[model samples]
Target: QYLCAIRPKDGRLVLSTMVYADEVNASDDIAELKAVSETELPDKELKMARQLVDSLAGDFDAERYTDTHRQKIMALIERKADGDTGLVEAPEAEAAGEVVDLMAALEASVAAAKDARKRHPTGVDEGEGEGEATTPEKAVRKKKSA
Candidate 1:
């Protein structure tokens, strides 16, 4: 039997192999397989770049992210599976006929998003029932009521 072990030695990673045998001298069979050098110390430019990246890093909260488009598609599939064909067709996107003022368009989009956030603080649309009761009875009641 052979066992491989890794350890840090002189700021480098050393891989050592040990042999275990019932009838053989294990010490004579043991070998220092290889040593992997540590990463080189960062240069001034690399240090600056690393610092810039570290400064931009922030805590990641996965709960704050959602695939709304995918959720919508799944909901549509569910509705179709349930034999509900009253799906609303989305309006066609109009082509950009001419060059638009980029800054003005960006400002308008920002303002619209702000207004939407104010209207739906929970980020859920009205009648979407995002936080509603999930019991089967409640679901049936909601469907009947609707």
Candidate 2:
């Protein structure tokens, strides 16, 4: 029901009642109704407002989005089920070439040795055994095993 409060002086419209259509367009004046004081809202108006809020709360269609990984997996599964035995071809093997540069090889070896020393600082290099004596003392003397 449309309402109008007429001014007594010149019979002009002072206030108009709030409107709510069955299906409100995206660009409607819902802001005016929102500004209305909670105490001033009639029970019917409050109910309608609650209904409108509830209607707008959830409207997303989750089915519209596709999971690409899942789709690919499903396709592979279906292919396997139907015995689609086509395998993707592997690349042709090419002839292996030597490194060819001596200085570059030495640099790489030095770098690797430095990295190994960094990994184990006090560790023995190459031929040194823990229980074995040093070679310097045995240089001038020969030992007889008992």
Query: What's the lDDT for all of these models?
Result: 0.55, 0.51
- Candidate 2 lDDT over 1-146, as tens digits, reads 43332221121112332233332233225454334333365679757765655564443333444556566778978998899998745669897987689999899999898668545635444566654433332335568999
Q: In terms of TM-score, which candidate is strongest? A: 1
RMSD of each: 27.5, 26.2
Per-residue C-alpha lDDT of model 1 across residues 13-120, encoded as one tens digit per residue: 444443222223323243442222324555795567556655754443335555566678999999999999895798799997998899999999988985785465
Worst lDDT 10-window in candidate 1: 19-28
**lDDT for predicted candidate 2 compared with the true structure:** 0.51
Using all chains and alpha carbons, the TM-scores for the candidates as numbered come to 0.35, 0.21
* Clash count list over all predictions: 0, 0
